[model samples]
Structure formats: C-alpha cells, structure tokens
Target: MKAVIQRTANANVTVDNQKVGEIEEGLVVLLGVTHEDGLEDAEYLAKKITNLRIFEDDSGKMNRSLKDVDGSLLSISQFTLYGDTRKGRRPNFMQAAGPEAAEELYEQFNDFVRKENVPVETGKFGAMMDVQLTNNGPVTLILESRE
Candidate 1:
C-alpha cells in the first residue's frame, strides 16, 4: 500500500460531471494497492496519515495532527502509483493489484480510517474521476507501507 497525502483547504471528486465526495480543511489521499498489500498495510498507513503532524498549532508551528485539527480525508484509489517506467518508453503496471483485490483493500483502508474517528470521503474505485483541491501550504508527502 502507498499514499500521496496532501494537506488541502478543500477538496472534491467528480465523476461524469457529478460530484461524489468533498471535504474542507483536510487531507486528500491518493491511495494505491499492490499485490502484497493486506490489512496490516492498511492499518499502518491509516495510523500514520491520521497522526501526521502537518497542521500548524497555536504558535504557528506545524505540530498538529489531522486528529488534532478535526480534519477530513478524501481517499482515492490509484493503481497507477505502481507504474514502473524504468524500462522502455511505456510504464508497466505489473506490481499493481488486480481490480477485485485492490478494491477490497481500498474499502478496508477507508473503513480503517473511519474507525480512527476522522471524517472520510472517497472517490469511486475504478472510475475516471476528477479531483480538485486547494492544497494548503502546498504540503505534500508520499508514504509507502513496504519501506
């Protein structure tokens, strides 16, 4: 499992010109699942994302976690995160999990996040969705479960 976490002032996902999910003052997560990912991977990433201290505190220090700020999460499944471009001009997606398995894990990840008590919004899995966000502080971070 892997995730690209971005702090955002607001975010939304649209599919076929219809908005499906949206959030304000939160994090937008582009999540990916690989063949080896399981519940443990989901658990690890969820914990890390929720506790990550990217929000500024009283003294204007970036020391508050999402939980501290009562932020939300917009999670989107992105198998392309596993694309390998090391060879040739085309990228290979052999490391990405098959859709059936990937979607299952994706839901599990969302469930885990909700269990952590933060509001969660999600994009439709396997859908071509448009994500819009006002990235707060332009703060972006990549998190990987395997390493």
Candidate 2:
C-alpha cells in the first residue's frame, strides 16, 4: 500500500458533479494498492498516517500529530499510482492490485483509520471523481507500507 498525504485547510471530492466526501483541517490521501499488499500493510499505514508529526506546534515547529491537531482524512483509491511507464508510451498497470482485492484492502485501511478515532471521508472506489483542496503549508508526504 502507498499513500500520498497532503495537509489541507480543506478538501472535497465530487463525482458526477455531486459532492461525496469533504473535510476541513485534515489530510487528503491518495491511496494505492499493489498486488503484494495485505491486511498488515493497510494496518501499518493507518497507524503511521494518524501519528505522523507533520503538523506544526504553536512554536512553529513540525511537532504535532493528526491526533494533536484534531484533523480528518480524505481517502481516495488511486490505482494509477502504480502505473508503470518505464518502457512504453502507455502506462502499464500490471503492478496494481485487481479490483476486488484492492477494494477489500482499501476498505480495511479506512476501517483501521476510523479505529484510531479520527474522522474519515472517502471518494467512491473505482469512480471517476474530482478532488479539490487548499493545501495547508504545502505540507505533503508519501508513505508506503513496505518502506
């Protein structure tokens, strides 16, 4: 599993011009699942994301976790993160997990996040959705379970 997490003042997801997920003072997560990923991978990332100290303290230092800052998370399944473009004009998606496996793990990831007592908003899996956000501090980070 891999996640691109961005701290945001606000964020929202829209599908077919209808708002689906929305958040304020949180992180927007573009999550990807690979065929090798399992429950442990999802569990690891959920814990890590919730506890990551990317938020700033009153002294202006990056010292606060999502728990400390009272933040939410907008999770989106992004199969294209595994797009492999090394040898062709077209990106290869062979590295991505199949839909059934990916969706299972994706839902599990969200469940684990919710277990941590944080609010979560999610884009519809496998849907063509639009995401919008005001990135706070321009703070962004990438996390992978294997790493």
Candidate 3:
C-alpha cells in the first residue's frame, strides 16, 4: 500500500459533476493498493499518517499530529500510484491490485483512519473523481508500507 498525503485547508471530491466527499483543515490522501497489500498494510498507513507530525505547533514548528490539530481526512483510491514508467512510453500498472481486492483494502484503510477519532470523507471507490484542495503549507509526503 502507498499513500500520497497532503495537508490541506479544504478538499472535496466530485463524481459525475456531483460532490461526493469533502473536508476542511485536514489531509488529502491519495491511496494506492498493490497485489501484496492486506489489512496490515492498511492499518499501518492509517496509524502512521494520523500520528505524523506535519502540522505546525504553537511555536510554528512541524510538531503537531493530525489529532493535535483537530483535522479531518479526505481519502481517495488511486491505483495510478503504482504506474511504472521505467519502460517504454506507456506506464505499466501490473503492480496495482485488481479492483475487487484494491477496493476492499481502500475501504479498510479509511475505516482504520476513522478509528483514530478523526473525521473521514472519501471518494467513490471505483469512480472517476475530480478532487479539489487548498494545500496548507504545500506539505506533502509519500508513504509506503513495504519500505
């Protein structure tokens, strides 16, 4: 499992021109699942991201966790994170998990994050979505379970 997390002032997801999910003063997570991913991977990322000290504290230091900042989460499944472009002109997606398995893990990841007591919003698992966000501090990080 992999996730691209971005601190955001606000975020939203739209599908078929209809808003599906949204959040304010939180993180936007673009999550990806590979064939080897399981519940453990999902749980691991949830814990890591929720506890990550990316938010600024009283002294303007990046020392506050999402919990400390009272933030929310907007999670979206994005298999494209596994797109391997090392070869020819086209990107290879062979490392990405099949839709059925990926969707299950995606839901599990969101559920685990929710268990951390932070509000969670999500895009449709297998839908084409338009995501919008105002990135706070432009802070972004890429996390992966395998390494």
Candidate 4:
C-alpha cells in the first residue's frame, strides 16, 4: 500500500459534475494498493498518517499530529501511484492491485482512519474523479508500507 498524503485547508472530489466527498482543514490522501497489500498494510498507514506530526506547533515547528489539529481525511483511491515509468515513455501499472481487491482495501483503509476518531470522507471508488484542494503549507508526503 502507498499513500500520497497532502495537508490541506480544504479538499473535495467530484465525479460526473457531482461532488462525492469533501473536507476542511484536513489531509487529502491519494491511496494506492499493490498486489501484496492487505489489511496489515492499511492498518500501518492509517496509524502513521493520523499520528504524523506535520502540522505546525508553537514557535513554528511542524509538531502537531492530525489528531492534535482536529483534522479530517479525504481519502481517494489512486491505483496510478504504482505506475512504473522507468522503462519506456509509457507508465506501467502492473504493480497495482486489481480493481475489485483494491477497492476492498481502500474501504478498509478508510474504516481504520475513522476508527482512529478522525472524520473520514471518500471519493467514489473506481470512478474518474476530479480532486481539488488548497494544500496547506504545501506539505506533501509519500508513504509506503513495504519500505
């Protein structure tokens, strides 16, 4: 599993001109699932993301966790994160999990975050989504379960 986590002032996802999910003062998670991913991978990422101290604290240090800042989560399924572009001009998605399994894991990931007491919103699974966000501090991080 991989997560491209971005701190955001606000974020939303739209599908077919209809808003699917939205959040404010939270993180926008572009989540990816590989063939090897399972519940354990989702569990690890959820814990890590919610506890990550990316928010600023007194004296301007990034020391506050999502919980500390009372933030929410906008999770979006993004199989393209596994795109391997090292070879040719085209990116290969062989490492990404199949759609059915990926969607299951995606839901499990959101359930884990919600269990952590962070308000969780999500984009439509397997849909072409238009995501918009005001990235807070421009803070972005990529997290992977394997390494």
Give the whole-model CA lDDT for all candidates, comma-separated: 0.96, 0.96, 0.96, 0.96
Candidate 4 Cα deviation (angstroms), residue 135: 0.7
lDDT, model 3: 0.96
Give the TM-scores of the predictions, in the order they appear.
0.98, 0.98, 0.98, 0.98
What is candidate 1's lDDT per residue for 4-93, written digit by digit as tens? 999999999999999999999999999999999999999899999999999999998999999999999999999999999999999999
In the range 1-147, model 2's lDDT, one tens digit per residue, is 989999999999999999999999989999999999999999999999999999999999999999789999999999999999999699999999999999999999999999999999999999999999999999999899996
User: For candidate 2, what is the TM-score?
Assistant: 0.98
Look at candidate 4 and give me any clashing residue pairs.
Answer: none
- In model 2, the worst 10-residue window by lDDT is 138-147
Itemize residue pairs with steric clashes in candidate 3. Answer: none
**Which residue segments of model 1 deviate by more than 4 Å?**
none
Error of 3 at 53 (Å): 0.3
> Candidate 3, residue 52: CA error in Å?
0.3
Off by over 4 Å in 2: none
CA shift of 5, model 1, Å: 0.4
In model 1, residue pairs whose N, Cα or C atoms come closer than 3 Å (at least 3 residues apart or on different chains), thus clashing, are none
lDDT of 4 at 44: 95
Query: Poorest 10 consecutive residues of model 1 by lDDT?
Result: 107-116
Off by over 4 Å in 3: none
Residue-wise C-alpha lDDT for candidate 4, range 5-119, written one tens digit per residue:
9999999999999998999998999999999999999999999999999999997999999999999999999999999999999999999999999999999999999999999
Tens digit per residue, CA lDDT, model 3, 25-126: 989999999999999999999999999999999899999999889999999999999999999999999999999999999999999998999899999988
